[model samples]
Target: MLVGAASMIDSVRTWLRPDPIAERQVDPVGFAGTATVAATDYFAWDQEDKPSRTTALDRIAEPGADIDGWNGAGKQRVDGVAVLDVNRFARELAVVTVQVHVIPFTKPAAPSQPGGLKASWTALPARWLTAAIPVRSLPGGRFALSGRPALVGQGHSADLGNDAATEPPDADFSADTTVVVSKLLTAYGTGDLEFVRAAGAGFLGLDGAAELAELDEWRVAPKADNSGVRIGTATVRWRLPGDATLACTYRIAISDRDGIWLLSAITVDAGGPR
Candidate 1:
């Protein structure tokens, strides 16, 4: 009974062709051998004087001038040709080192995928993952020392129709260096204070007000007496001069948001006394 029902459904589908008339038309440009060429006849030539040919061959091979006979044509000696010496050639060369630092506002959770997930699944959320660090300027120092900040975590997605299963999320930071300082300074000097504040707060890990205040060499400290907000001496060892390097350190403190202070970012300086 099931087979008969399936056959009836198939018949109905076959009858519903959208362009039945167009499908029935035949093509006019059919394949066929239309024309042929005739074969031609061949002819042979008589041989030349054998004694003259022998004498000519003997004269040609008389000495080193034509020692190899007629076949030794256009051979000459080449001198001082330039070529690459294998020992002197450089191969696949690269130098210097790179380091990256990241600090999360909140600790990242483990990856989870919910559902009978397919291998081709792709989805990314639209949000900003932020980290905060410290920035300081020395007394009478024109430049400020900015630390690194980043998002170092993964995300997960739940399975369709089943809330229990989830998929993994990829996490990364947008800005990873202190070069943004020049732009931030320009924004501040031009009275685009909000832009300056936002850029400093996001990149240097300072609060909006703190970022504004720090424009004039303000001091930074922990909220409470015992909270550890002050980051001590940060020594940057130069591997290569005028190259960017990143480092980070964290401390606990009491504040409006759990007092967990995270500091991160890349620093560049004029190769200090060495």
Candidate 2:
């Protein structure tokens, strides 16, 4: 009886006629493809490319049947679609990180249904699996992961070079260093490129290479509060574009250059030094 009911529901869904109201609501620009889904690519939103919201759909449809003729063009029907706003998602993750404890984890062999003429996670009379992935970002520097079996099986390949120093700095620049680190991360969270540009300077960021670090939610604490000689430590996550993120805790040294505090030395967590 349950199987019969399920089959009946499937048949109903397949036989149902398309909704004209819903068809009118489809966005041509967004429908262009994944490249435009991020909205960061110029081709996705270029005025010349998107003459009307439905230009792509209209072009292939029969002249008189504007909205009703795409099927005649032999294109498969679409069920549902969505776009991810990664930046907004990142912000939301940030908030969640501050509000809760998130234990990092990874899950493999997760299940799914496949689809399309080509092979995919949902494509069959099959039991397929995949890994967990991030789907959205949260507030206070947090992000969430989602899994689709279709995206499984792909392996990552990249090399991380190393050259950072290994020793913690002398315990003399704690307060100033803490303030600098705080400001740097705050500016990074807000995407303030200018501030980030300045912070990447010799005395602000440990290395002059400040732009390399992205995913910036972090914690900083003073190792010693000797007033005259302050030492601090921080654990940070760096999300490099198209690369694996690296987690490390490092130390810093602040200097007084004519009254203004500036960072002068940095020691990345090199396994040898905690």
Residues 1-274 of candidate 1: C-alpha lDDT, one tens digit per residue: 9999999998888778635544533221110000000000000000122343334333322122211111111111111111111110011111011111211122113323367442331222222222221122122221121222211111100111111111121111112212233344333223343433321233232222111211211112212244432211121111111121112222111112243223322222111111
Model 2's alpha-carbon lDDT is 0.28
Worst ten in a row by lDDT for model 2: 93-102
Give candidate 1's TM-score: 0.14
Off by over 4 Å in 2: 1-177, 184-231, 242-244, 272-274
Overlapping backbone residue pairs in candidate 2 total 25
Residue 76 shift from truth in candidate 2, angstroms: 33
Clashing residue pair totals per candidate (backbone < 3 A): 18, 25
| Tens-digit lDDT track of model 2 for 1-274 | 9999999998787569645444334222222232122111111121122343245533322223212101111111112222322111222111000001111212213423354243221111212111111222212222222111011111211111111223344334433355566654434333342433323333222222122243233233333454332224444544322222333343434434445544333333212111
